[model samples]
Target: MKSGQLNRRVIVQRATSVSDGAGGQVREWPEIGRPWVKASLWSTGRGAGGGQSAVADVMQDNQAFVIRMRPRDIATGDRIVLDGLNYRVRAVVDPNGRRRELQVSIELEVPENA
Candidate 1:
């Protein structure tokens, strides 16, 4: 894939644990950088949230985006933000088997909407 084909601008974020000083940890997502990626969305549907009785807590499994980039700088826990939507990294694969290009599978989360 050509680098110029990456049209989507996404902010890269890493999940970090901050010391609370109370023997507990506060989780935070800190922005590491921004990278342009080529995104392809698929399989948008509603997903179950919590328990069956908690229908109010139901979530929408909207659009799993496949992003193509160079190398595998992102891990499973890391995520990308684009247009107010959070795309959590599900998996990363090198298509060339030489680490030249990485295809990242992501699950999209739209806050309360999904």
Candidate 2:
């Protein structure tokens, strides 16, 4: 039998600002946590980004992402359908090794306007 899919909670963090020990401040020194991220892996493939250099150079692309539902309802390797849109899961990774949090990247089928 095939294994059942599971859903997990993940937090997305972005750099912010905070006070230093000496009552000073710095950029990219603080991070704010975004809660309630729901996504699942649809499929996996060779990373898309590449560069030509002295040696064969390649880099892992941001995992394609699609928000499946509001609040939270998705799992690893599950196709996400959000707002009538679709995205694929690349992978979930730890953020910066500063704290234990999962970072998920999703590639939008259609780009959004800011």
Task: Note the Cα lDDT for every prediction shown.
Answer: 0.71, 0.37
Instruction: Tell me how far the alpha carbon of residue 52 in candidate 1 is from the true structure, in angstroms, after superposition.
Output: 31
Model 1 clashing-pair count? 0
lDDT by residue for model 2 over 46-110, one digit each (tens)?
33222111111211343344222232322343333444444433344443444334444455434
Off by over 4 Å in 1: 43-61, 110-114
TM-score, cand. 1: 0.74
**Number of the predicted model whose TM-score against the real structure is largest:** 1
Q: Spell out the clash pairs found in candidate 2.
A: 16-30, 40-78, 41-77, 41-78, 64-88, 64-107, 65-106, 65-107
Clashes of 2: 8
- Prediction-by-prediction clash tally: 0, 8
TM-score to true structure, per model: 0.74, 0.28
TM-score, candidate 2, is 0.28
Tens-place lDDT digits, model 1, residues 9-100: 89999999999999999989999889888876543433322112222122245567667777746887698897888888777767558987
Q: Model 1 misses residue 14 by how many Å? A: 0.9
**Candidate 2 lDDT score relative to the true structure:** 0.37
